[model samples]
Target: MTIRESKRLWMACGVGLLWFLLLLWPMLGIKPDGLEFATTFKVFGYVAVAAVFIMFFYQVKEAGYLDSVGKPVKGAAGALAAAYEKAPTWLLLGIVMAGAIVYPLVTERYAHDVAISVLIYVCLGLGLNVVVGLAGLLDLGYIAFYGVGAYTYAILSINYGLSFWLCLPIAAFIAAIAGCIIGYPTLRMRGDYLAIVTLGFGEIVRLVLNNWMSLTNGPNGILSIPRPELFGYEFRSLSSMYYVILGLAVVTILAVYRLNYSRVGRAWEAIREDETAAELMGVNTFLLKLLAYAMGATFAGFAGAFFAARMKFVGPESFTFLESAMVLAMVILGGMGSIPGVILGVLALVALPEVFREFELYRMLVFGGAMTLMMLIRPAGIWPAKRVGRRSEEAE
Candidate 1:
């Protein structure tokens, strides 16, 4: 059969088998969490409908109802396999986008706290992707910028009684400065040495926060960090923070996307491929690396400032090495250098704990096991850059 005809049948089988896969989740004598069921069902229902619609579109298109004047090689099976490999990841994206939108509409619809936390991480992941994934800089001290932003906002808002709105830019600027400070000395290192230095930098920042009682109030942290008030219509409702965070997340994604495609992005890619070669090509490798570090930290700082303002409390414990490593892990686990991949990694890492609460005690163990399996199964990443092309008989 021709490649086109082969794919038509392959997709058909995939759709047909989806139902059976759902059944594998187990329905026999299943116990439900009655209260959360409605919310859960709403989430699943929207996802299911989206999946059906997509499949319907694909079905109609394949039947020649939709004209495709174009189309790949490796015979029927190899090309079919390549197509199938990509389908699941894209399908999962549609489901995730749908869930993120309708999630707030579920009962108890305004889980602002949960929503804000998620967005903060989203911002964090995007930022880290630049450093670890794009620039090939392994940063384990990201939380330093976070702490700086938090304290910058905290001190300014409390002592000077400055508005959170006004403090936002200042917080970001200070975080950028902190990023430069950390990046300067560490520019000469790479790999594990870089990781260790960054890790130490993070500890130093936290210790300063913990012992600088004269300035930070030490362990007590700051309290009642002001929340964003829009047009004097302050957010008394939970959804307000949700919308604010959503707005920030949208901005973060956009900025990161632009950076990913810009001239600077090309420089980072060159550096990632080979630092020495990139520098030799007049890329200003050292400066670019520092820029990545600063820019990445600035993103975290923005999120941290917002986090402090939203939560109304902050402390050293919250911004630690573990948090830094976790964010890096998300970026790495999600295909490094892939924006969407980093996002997926964050969602899975963050959500799995909530989804499988029954296995709470073994969460870390399960997490390690899953990572090990992922390494074995998809060594490149959950979403690698592209399929490496191979020679064909026709080309030969």
Candidate 2:
């Protein structure tokens, strides 16, 4: 057989072997009914999935022909005009519809936890991208706004009798306000100093939540947060929440894309490329910086609100620095400036782990190692920013 066929056959066999081993876990010396057994099986599953992903990554890297894209992408567009020209909206619409229909089937029968988490992360990552990726702002405590959103919805709706739908806008508004508070002082700060400030800011929020018993109920957090419903039906199942999250994610993606190509987006880009030059050219750099921060925070808030509504839980611990790091990693690791790349990065890093179920701890370690290695190899990310095609090529 040819090498390609041989590879496929080997992969198929490997998968079969994995399933056999998964089934045999209980039959081994481990006790089936004990907590230890469950934990051990979970770890086994994680190691298996991690091994598979690493193997896949290595195989693809060795191939060296295809770029390490987060996911499939349309051809590169050099400018806003190019993106508009190449996008072909109708086809994109068709694909979105197909996805919406498929999302329910996949999440309901197969699994829901990981997919939901990824969808939430997708929204959060896209939100953070506005600041970190497009606007060149470092927001280490982006999760603070997420907490704000979640707590806003949870507190208002649960305590004072508000609706989940009403809380969405309110949560966003609160997050925007918080963003302005952070952005005003830090506009002049950039790079390491700014990074440290944001990190500190995130910690401050978490501490406040822990200490401010009246404001955040200390460690208890807001529980029994109401879920969104369509018409008379509450989003009772995980599948129900999946659709809601998916809709929000789509909206977030579209909004980010629009901003990326709009006048403000250009202004942000100008600032990112050279802050002094942008100011020299009358970009209103300060206001734009604040706007970027507010908008980015607002989106995170929306995601956090949705998360609160679905899970019916909101705790300070939920919006920790590690969460911030993971979200930032998703944005940077995905490809800072590329939407498709970001999506792919989220899927691989966020979605894959939830589905696999076997390798949570070790998988994280492996991914951390892989990311460090990737920084050395391709710092721009898996899908590097594409330069404009030469006009000389048109003559040919």
Count clashes in each candidate, considering only residues at least 3 apart in sequence or on different chains.
0, 4
Put down candidate 2 lDDT per residue, 243-298, tens digits, no spaces. Answer: 88888888888899899889998898888878999999999999999999999988
Measured against the true structure, the TM-scores of the candidates, in listed sequence, are 0.73, 0.76
Residue-level lDDT of model 1, residues 239-315, one tens digit each, is 76776777778788889989988999878988887999888889998899999998898888888888888778889
Candidate 1: regions farther than 4 A off: 1-102, 109-112, 386-396
Question: Which residue pairs of candidate 1 clash?
Answer: none
Clashing pairs in 2: 45-358, 46-358, 46-359, 70-344
On lDDT, the candidate that comes out on top is 2
User: Once all C-alphas are superposed, what RMSD does model 2 give against the true structure?
Assistant: 8.7
Which of the numbered candidates is closest to the native, going by highest TM-score?
2
Judge candidate 1 against the unseen true structure and give its global Cα lDDT, from 0 to 1: 0.79
